[model samples]
Target: MIIFIDSYTEEKLANSLAGRPGYFKLFYDTENCGCNGVLAIEILDQPLDTDIRISVKNFTFLVDKQQESLFDDALKLEADRSYPSFKVSSDSALYSTNVRIKDARDMASK
Candidate 1:
């Protein structure tokens, strides 16, 4: 799947990374949500061997090879500078309107 990140949202993400080595991940967070978990955008420093790369303008997002089917092939990501969450959608339906941004850079890498 391809995700188009808006210019403003991209700027915020870049600032969050702070020039540190990292990549974005379309995370399917199943923690407390349920079997049908909420989606999130995660920033991480480690490159995983199980990732399927989806390239954007200046960055590439990684998705778990097994969970690639959870998203639409073409999607748009948007966010308001005032809020910390994001909205992900496609032509067919709105997947999630308040997808959280989870910065996992501080967690121990696998």
Candidate 2:
């Protein structure tokens, strides 16, 4: 699989990885929010016991085995510095989602 991570995202990921070790794992899955089925993205430290792992651009990503069909050969992930959010695009569609950046103090309490 081919995935693109913009420079800003790469920098942020590098910093996060350095400090938190394995704090986040990119994940893609299909979910039904209301009526329509949508792709879901999650950043979690550990993968579900049954999740499948894939590597792209030296980054580890996880996806449920059931969601493998939704995985496209080409995936684009870009970080928009203007909004400080990330956008994901695949063969099917393009969408933007916010990245939840938790403060260190907040995370420490969790």
Candidate 3:
């Protein structure tokens, strides 16, 4: 599968990832939500060894193997200027319009 991230989206993500030792996670949050789950971009400081990595242009995304089938072969990550979040979509469907960025870094220690 191929993931596309535009310049604007890259810049926005870079600003948050700058100097931070973390990995981008394309997470399918199903723990909270019912029948359908929500798609979110998570910045995790430590990723699980079982996580599958999806390489894009200048970055990589870690996703659960079980949830890998939820995405299409091609995907796009875009920036949402209206809010401090992002949007994940593809030609086949609009996954999430208001996809949130969850930074799992320890902010208290830093």
**Whole-model Cα lDDT of every candidate shown, in order:** 0.82, 0.58, 0.82
What's the C-alpha lDDT at position 32 in model 1? 85
| Tens-digit lDDT track of model 1 for 1-110 | 88888899888777767888788898788898758778888888776899998888888789998888877899988886677778888988798888876778869843
Off by over 4 Å in 3: 107-110
- True-structure RMSD for candidate 3: 2.3
**Candidate 2 local lDDT, 3-96, one digit each (tens):** 7787777786555555554433344422445543444444556677867776656567666766656657677776667774567778676644
TM-score of each: 0.87, 0.63, 0.86
lDDT of 2: 0.58
Per-residue lDDT over 27-51 for candidate 3, one digit per residue giving the tens place of the 0 to 100 score? 7788868857778888887667878
Model 1's lDDT to the true fold? 0.82
lDDT of 2 at 75: 74
| Backbone clash count for every predicted candidate, in the order shown | 0, 0, 0
